[model samples]
Target: MTPPPPSTGQPGPATRRTVLRALAALPASALALGAAPGLLTTATAAAPARGYATRYTVVPFLDSSDAGVSVYQSDDATDFRLIKAAAYTPPANRVRDASVLKHTDGRYYLTYTTHTWQDTSTTIGFARSTDLVNWTFLYDYTVPIMNLSRAWAPEWFVDGDGSVNVLVSCSTTADEWTFTPYRLKAADSALTSWSAPVALSGIGANHIDTFVVRAGSTYHAFTKNETTKYIEYATAAALTGPYTFRGTGDWAGWGGTREGPALVQLDNGAWRIFFDGYGDGSYYYSDSYDTFATWSAPAKLPAVSGTVRHFTVLKETVTGGPTLPTGVTRSFRSANYTTRYWQEQSALVNLPVVGSASTTAEKQAATFTIVAGLADSGGCSFRNAAGNYLRHYDFRARFDAHDGTSTFAADATFVLRAGASSGSVRLESYNYPGRYLRHYDYQLRVDAADGTDLFRQDSSFAAVTAWA
Candidate 1:
């Protein structure tokens, strides 16, 4: 491992809470974009074209009682729910401000702070995982900064040149609560070695939790302003550069006391930024349709607000992964609303009444081949008579041709859980763990189980004799 260059400085003493909170509210120093965890490939490719299927894996810091990171998955970025509560907890370290990257070798790498806000340290921890749930300790790396009070909030940044880097906020003086952004470049693709730390220029001191993304030739950085307590914006021509702050002190319209600004591009070419509202203990996100110039009002992340802190989100595009079996046909009859049956018309899946007077086409539309799940064979995929698959797009169930992508496979596959009612089975979404295939207003859609009898009955279906 390459030793980071040494620097001269002197230390002072201060409480960890003040230093960490001040650093959290610090301003932008520098930024860069890195691959989000859960991606199976190594290529740092650009975002997929609009309409392509994608999955977003979110890692956030849970409250103090949970002392580790939690993992969440979402189809639409807005509705993120817990996938694992204890995704990665460092052995003797706190997983504060954890950043994830799926390396080229197809393993998930996590870089996080080694201590809580009460202790000062110059080292950050690293871990690796094959599956996002299980992680193995890699090593603890000490930043080579002399008299460093704290090295906090390490975030992975992949430059446009394909070089991997980590942006860390370092405070030299202990009592003053001053922090400046510094970065260490990965010396190799394995990320086991790193170059010396260098301070980011133009983005002066007192900024923390800086997250960056690239759009064309421009680099956009969203960082917190420690002094003003608002997330600010800056841009640079190069990755490690003279970043000029374009917006500061409420320029983005989000109120103060926000930190940990993380950005990810949506499948529709739009941009979304997630930030920590430490003051109110809520997590909020805002969308930008026209780059970073204008943003919608911040909205609390449903079910995620007040639950997590200082997190990062990784979006991975999947193709040709996850498969299903094609075999016997079956029909689904609604358990609660026995008169209605799962039917397809004009490519949409819905619950409609089917009786002896129903036509042959109606009967055929209601019947489907119960194939082994496209994503997980343990589950099942429904195939229509015309060779189309019953899949959920934008959370709505429909009959669409197989796209041979992992997203399609996951959307199409439904795990057969024991029915909410006796002798009935509820179709749970393979990708979204707690969500099930249910009918809302007679339209088939995947919704989270709300623990109500109506929801249980709506999601439960009985396998009747094939109508076709």
Candidate 2:
């Protein structure tokens, strides 16, 4: 089946037939990667500490404009939703290809391209944030490059020695794409001062969006080969060095016309690389279990694909945050699909459009009493109209009479999280910490979080007036 047009970051117009058709046509490889089809869910029996976040915050630019900088967050890298839109638009400058880093001073800092590709720029923009949401403009630190035509895609890299640096793509020729990576070191802890620009060796001109991460004694670099548009991999012993580039063309199977490669390490120690498939106007992320030696085929970033342009993600652990409320009879409204609500059908949960035309029975099916968790007090359980509870059976969400078993209690209970989107909430399975209560093809299920934009929005719900 032909896939539907990409979502416009709003409630989609997918009907049941289109959804089922799309599901039926999903590739086996996609199914294997949890991209949707039959159940590919995993229920690992372990939970993280309550009220702390091992969070992944994505800072992506919608475009090279004043309203471009936006912030998104996810529990499992696969599911991301917006935390703040236009979180910070730099004063009098366009924000593009932005990178974020939590500095040692307990503040978040941003580095980005100050102008569009059509304009000549010599400075990279900067900003500081106490929380990831609000921002204060710092300064547009000029790149110390002679006859610089543009300084683009400034990525933040903290060295092994605890020094901060920005890897920027520099070009001296106007209207030409020929560019090379340069290292700009922060001269002071305030990040207001920087050292002279030093050209990186071996990675010659025409390479851009260079993101570097040091593992052990080697620095692994992922840069876009401008000519081929394939994200190439390179390694060096030093920060600025004679690097070796491999997997030149189609080496990793992430097709060409990709750029702005950013990487973040998962809690499980695996790596995920995100890039823009500009040729098709999509954002794709690929995972590597054994580092960059191998990679899973790139998958679209659900709600974010076709929306955000070049971006980067920052992973951090948040502690002592807010907790979920109990004893509230509330109805859950889908974040992305505003008119939809969580409703029960034949003892199974689904996200269906709940509106005034529906009968009283239809409203009750969409209502649930949020109560203290049967398994863990820190979490919550959804109890429905007939006194049955919502639980995951074989990874599928179903409403059933409580069996009074420990496993049933655990399966029914979920840890509440501040939603990826503002004023929303995410339900993390109590037994499978990283897994969440989300809808796949409109059917409710407990699935492992894979770090997709779709997963992020599907798992996020807003507590609203009870439908009953």
Candidate 3:
């Protein structure tokens, strides 16, 4: 839907009806992502451990005079602590709609609109950082369009082939303008060279504040319909796209007001969409289980220390060993032999086998914390409560607390496969992909699958909380 008259600064009733009608006419299957229609609900699941300390860093626009990029970080998305109040100052001294992207090369790039509000300018500010704290302003570019009066809300996405593309809202008219999303490609890692602007299609007319995120194999673009002041989305298979329009959803239940949409995937695998409630001077968010078809009622995030607007959230990876989840320690109980538990014997972590236990002390030996193994390759190593790791020696499962050698790490790592039931997971040794961790006749060994029902049952184990 095209935006309402530009100079009015408000949409009339007819414009609102047009937007509502457009939203209602969207295909139900497209809107629900193939799920049954229902009110927005939140999904509850165990927060997936990052296998390391992962940080969520936010970059928000402060204000006009001091409208520098502000940095805030949180381990969990629920609690944000300010890191740097003014991480970088724009060359124009006025900035809004700040977006940050961490490139594959380990450098960070920040882009924003150099002008605030209706005062149009062709300049879009740019900066880069090796460390998120200190940013060096690389130089701003004026869109090549001759009549370009505004360049606002510049956001960026990195392609699979390592190319960086910047998307920005631009308008040619100074007063009565229709803002549209356009793209620019950076030629190098430093973002010093850029290609000319190319208009994005399939997002409808007069859209702004574009943000794109990948869910599974599809790329979803979320943007504000500047005319209707409602948030809508489209999906594309590739980074540069002939994007297909999805459906529109109201932000925080507010119609014709919410703008500058941003998104973040939480540790619990829930997707959150954040929008600026400019009328209330607060940022509101909604959670979605699927890719953004339906949404939970918009709720305000914990208030930041200062006035913030039009921001971006980025997940930062910290270098270190795996940081095990606080309460993920579990015991593996054999499915075939219900009373038997996997245990590691001796302080050296040798002789790992399934054994019957009658007392609490005996059962404690079976408890283990699954940790990321061997260079944090997403495979896991079980660390017994005795501080020893379950590793394979000579193709036989054993315990080895002191095997700091690469061989031990490689042998110890196992890729976990989800079983048919809840709280059930199967372990496949990294060294032997076709083989699994199974106990044959109560002896722990890594054996090849025989394609028998009994073999599958023997390979599976129920992960239960350790005995009290």
What is the C-alpha lDDT profile of model 2 across 140-196, one tens digit per residue? Answer: 988888887778778888876788888887777543346778888889999999999
| Model 2 worst lDDT run, 10 consecutive residues | 32-41
After superposing candidate 1, which stretches have Cα over 4 Å from the reference?
1-53, 174-176, 319-352, 358-468
Q: How close is each model in CA RMSD to the real structure?
A: 10.5, 11.6, 15.7
TM-score of every model?
0.66, 0.65, 0.59
The C-alpha local distance difference test score for the whole of candidate 2 amounts to: 0.72
> lDDT of model 1 at residue 276?
70
Quote model 1's TM-score: 0.66
The CA lDDT at 71 in model 2 is: 91
Candidate order, lDDT descending: 2, 1, 3
Please provide, for model 1 over 156-218, each residue's C-alpha lDDT reduced to its tens digit, 9 standing for 90 to 100. Answer: 877766788888887764432567778789998889899998877777676666777878887
Ten-residue region with minimum lDDT total, candidate 1: 32-41
> Candidates ranked by TM-score, best first?
1, 2, 3
Candidate 3 per-residue C-alpha lDDT over 151-261 given as tens digits, one digit per residue, 9 for 90 to 100:
766777665555778877667664324566777888876777889878777764466667777665677787776555677778887655678877765533545566677
* Highest lDDT scorer: 2
